[model samples]
Target: MEVVFERVEGRRYRVGVRRSGRHDTGPDVPPRVGVGAPVGDVPHDLVHLAIEEALGLRLGIFGQVAAGGDLGGFFTPPPADRSPLRDKRRSQRLARAGRSDTGLSESLAACVGHDGRLRGADELLTPAELGRVQRRLTALVDAWRATPPGGELVVTWPEHLTVRRGVLPSD
Candidate 1:
């Protein structure tokens, strides 16, 4: 999977996740999944969950991010050009939140109910399941924060973006 985080405007960003190995031979090709939102809209605790869903990670009984131990990597910066506009916008958002804008990437994730489908960077989960995911993600974020300043956050993908499972929560 290749996740592209594009700066839309201000602190808003558009995240597109595409399956690798697919040829974009035509103009009608579409990404496997996509999501977008401003940094402050979603609760920080749920960001990883949102990214997993946007990347089609929870279609199975177990999501890949939960299965894998590299959730901290998602906080890594994308391998994209950083424009002055994006930097300034991100800095402004961080400053408003009383956090240092320098050498930090502000990220937020949440799930939105759209057309009877959950969208954005979160998965639909039961209260118990949500709590479990929250704890896991919080630990990951803490590790990410502990990384040396100027270190990059890189999001790596599993060979398959989605897997099949016999059982998962319907709600």
Candidate 2:
């Protein structure tokens, strides 16, 4: 599976954890779940963080579905027909994207130079420190389940999903 991104509206964005396969590129591309906010120029670090976190959760969900007694003896494999080597490569990409230390933060701060108020995750990471950003993201996901019913915030799973075949780029 690959991480695909789409814009809902304005800064609101949705990133899909799509299994490879299928060519319908319209609004109905791969079955994707929304994560974080929609964005136009998302910083490199946030994109990586969102993809890694979302993929990890989706994999867990797949495992659960396969293990459910309803599946019976049927077994489901991991996404993308990925071998262990391919999986490692994908992981490395995510790690690289998510890498943000104090230095990047300092540089980003100088660039922005108090130009505007921070929005979304930016409010919490003006310096773009990875550890701080990761902690904030954990808090957000924890609250995902606690969002009140019918609230603007919601976390849901599709009725069903199938992972298809596709080539994931090393970059």
Candidate 3:
């Protein structure tokens, strides 16, 4: 799969994916999936969730930075204590905070659909705290491409900042 990260404006970027074929030129061509956001607009929580779901790396925000900012530093979580009361309390807290563990899945569903059309382009992230999140995302993407779990995955950021197919890695 080819993933193109195109700058739309300022720090805003749009991610597009194509499952097959080389980059083509045409107005009618549509990516298999697409999502757009400013670099600062991408949530740290969501990035962490996506890394966990897509790469099976459970390096939580705190631990990720402490481990020298690499995927190899990820470690398995300790087994949770099987307590029904604790589970109930945790669920209630999450509900109150309007957060869910399925953040990655829900975000993907909102952005990319079965028809591959883009959606939810207006969701704005909270202002970045210290630019650490952006750095974290870059590191995560580099690690993902280095050892893609499923197959060859390519991610590119266009120089001209247009929503066109980026140069493939093989090019």
Candidate 4:
């Protein structure tokens, strides 16, 4: 799935996801806008993405989105598929996605916002992996700050972060 981060102006921003198998976001695109006063130089969700990708949190927010979960209406569903039963099954599938390092991702994201660093070697990430997160955050924040208002900074949430097709995870 494609993650779109748009600079509305100043600290205002909009974030939206284009799910897999989707192309050409026309006028009907759901406006997943967030007007947040983010603590760090980068948006909070962006931090989550960077940290999550570095640590590989498959059942995290973006991963759920990639697997087509609306994430409690953070994203809007397609107009064509209106079946509530289908939605229920999707939710069930997501629940079956089980635990991920989402809690860790959140903690690390908060750490970056406050202390701006991660200590060497822990259960969540090793020294090298922490270094990777720092490097990635640096690059992503640099690019994000450079983007002009009304412009988009596109990102990809790895689809394989979720379960493989047809291999139903036990509930």
Best by lDDT: 4
Candidate order by TM-score, decreasing, is 4, 1, 3, 2
Query: Which is superior by TM-score, 3 or 4?
Result: 4
lDDT of 1 by residue, 21-132 (tens): 3421101112211233322432232354333443344322113222211122322232355444543343333233323211121222324221112233233455554455
Which portions of model 4 miss their true places by more than 4 Å?
A: 20-29, 35-37, 92-99, 114-123
TM-score of structure candidate 1 = 0.30
How would you encode candidate 2's per-residue C-alpha lDDT over 1-171 as one tens digit per residue? 333344344344444333332431112123233443222234232333332243332222222221121111112233454355554454444334323422333333233212122234444343445344355445544453334433333222222322122322342
Tell how far residue 153 is off in model 1, in angstroms.
6.1
Q: Relative to the unseen true structure, what is the C-alpha lDDT of residue 25 in candidate 4, on a scale of 0 to 100?
A: 21
- Best of the candidates, TM-score: 4
Candidate 3 per-residue lDDT over residues 111-149, each given as its tens digit: 432223223523523334113333445564454434422
- lDDT of candidate 3? 0.32
RMSD in angstroms between candidate 2 and the native structure over all alpha carbons: 14.1
lDDT by residue (48-103, candidate 4, tens digit) is 78887776777666665666555434545445645656655765576456345556
Q: What are the lDDT figures for the candidates, one per model?
A: 0.33, 0.32, 0.32, 0.65
Stronger candidate by lDDT (1 vs 4)? 4
